[model samples]
Target: MASNIDKYKSDLQKLLKLGQQLYYAMNYEVFEDKFIKNIRTVMNSDEEVTKFIKDLPDFDLKYQPWYSESLVLIKQLLPDRLGDFIKYYEKPKNRKLLESDNYTIEDYLQGNIRNQSFKIATSVGLDAALPQFRQQLSILQSIQARFESSLFDIRQLVQADFFDSELAAAKELLKHKFARAAGAVAGVVLEKHLFQVLCDHHIAIKKNPAINDLNEALKKNSVIDTPQWLFIQRLGAIRNLCSHNKINEPTPEEVGDLIAGVDKTIKTIF
Candidate 1:
């Protein structure tokens, strides 16, 4: 009687030979639909097997001869079940192997099918989802970096005794930093609001000049502007003070108020 490993090997071989035939020989369109459906079903039904397959390295089986050999052996063992499928395995090397004894039909068949099924499924899903995932990730990362830098600027302002500085110098630095932070926040919020407006009302703005445009658009769309705009402006100024090493900065309390205001704005907008 075949051992569990042998049975698995046999099943794998049959599937691999079929996938190779479908993918290489017949072109991807021939059995892609059926192959994908069956693989998904098997993955869902067998958690352990799915895990094992997912854990395998992503390169050719030459790196793990035993695993590769087992797959090939499996494929040859199920010729009747996979003969039609082998039409897909039209690659020169694969075709050669199918006709050679370099690897057992059983092992080669099993490994190839299991690996190919996993490869195809993952490739298709990732290809479809990666762009959206990356976009969201980039947005979150930018938000995190902005918040961190804001906190750092606030700390430096307190240490520099900005509150005790001359009024003119302090005000100038304050304005600069405020603009910077406002711009960052505006960039995030405007994009979001504009997209929403376009989707809901079929209204679109081809170009955004500044945060003012976003504010006006929001007002036009019946969305209330958040007080956070003021805070973002303040944060931008604080950022400038630190960047330029300006003398006489705003008080910690004043900066705190700005940050709080911006946070409030974010809460309202989001």
Candidate 2:
């Protein structure tokens, strides 16, 4: 009896010959219809073909190109049945190819599999990182809320002092100066906190880095140097003005600039 491999090879050759005849001889309509109908009758009579047909993935029953169609039919006939066929006919001939030796087949397969696995892992890692980013954003928002609350309270206190005996007894000329001094001090504190929070979030400079060390690090990670950083710096300056009581009312332009800076920094980091 012929081995399974020999049988498969013979069938494949027959299939190829039929295809060539159809392509070159232009007798495909006649040959394919009659030959395929006869083959189907034979296949239906054979237990092996019955088994093969049962293993195929769902496909239109009327589709032709018999060799490819037969392979799918065989697969559907027996689930995971190809593994046995592969082991018998497709095992690597070179043992060195099975071993991970330099440019061997094993090494190539390993590299391909590793790359596929890494793509899956990277996708999962990005999904996991999103929640952490949201948490960091929430913390920054909380800091902003606290800062605003503190500034409002300071403003109220400064306003109350206008009616205080100390301010009332003072010359009218020094009253404006006193209010400005209070605002300036509040603005400085607010700026300091903004800087501290950014550093805490790892979105700004390291707190204790020496100037030289910082410069060297920046050189290495120069891509991190961004317009967002400049925006944050400008926002801090505006916060400083408010905290220090230099201006009783900050301009809308200053507030908008500060908001834009914070937004840019958040977007870049996350």
Candidate 3:
């Protein structure tokens, strides 16, 4: 699966590629009717956006009213990046720039207005009427960095929730007097949670991590103390004993200890 960063990069790259193409087409004076259609496809929106806005108040207005909503897919797939892109995109545009001679509908109707339009787009958007390329790039970079950190936090939260559910299921098993079952469940949860924490921190571990391997890995990474590591290893042994009847099954008290240890580790460190 592709990461969110990859998708965000793709979206930004697509926009830049389109912008460059448009620039070149205007610069070179491409075909007459086709470039008009190309510009329409690129700039003019045929899609309606206002339907997403619910419960708009009904009122009479003397002046023209404008309303807009962005494409839903853009925000959903590239939520963090696109959201911040939209937010601060026009901040520098609020500043004034030296006014250029205004073009009318007549200017657009005349041939060879592509250069004029391209010049305007390059300097400043028509609506905003100001140009700040450096500031725009800086803001965009800051937004991307923040989006990355926010994605990391979201991963942590999702892992935490999954661990919470697994731990609770193990306790419920124990409540039903399924001591052996509870020990195995708690042990599995412990291993999975530890692996998730490692992933959250971008730590690489061996594939199909074992409990003892995880315990040592956690300690080596300063994720747990030596005593806690040893305790976790013992819990792994309890899980092994519970799994095999050749060794005596773990008692309820032993299983309770397993659950308690897992719970404590989750609460304190996770």
Error of 1 at 41 (Å): 47
Q: CA lDDT of each candidate?
A: 0.37, 0.36, 0.53
lDDT of 3 by residue, 135-206 (tens): 223333443454557454445435556666777788899899888888888888788877866775567899
On the 0 to 100 scale, the lDDT of residue 194 in model 1 is 37
Off by over 4 Å in 2: 1-223
Off by over 4 Å in 3: 1-152
> Candidate 2 — worst ten consecutive residues by lDDT sum?
121-130
User: What count of clashes does model 2 give?
Assistant: 23
Which pairs of residues collide in model 3?
none
Better of 1 and 3 by TM-score: 3
What are the RMSD figures for all models against the true structure? 23.4, 27.2, 16.8
- Model 3 Cα RMSD, 1 decimal: 16.8
Q: After superposition on all CA atoms, how large is the RMSD of candidate 2?
A: 27.2
lDDT of 1: 0.37
Which candidate has the top score in lDDT? 3
Give, for candidate 1, the lowest lDDT window spanning 10 residues: 121-130
lDDT of 2: 0.36
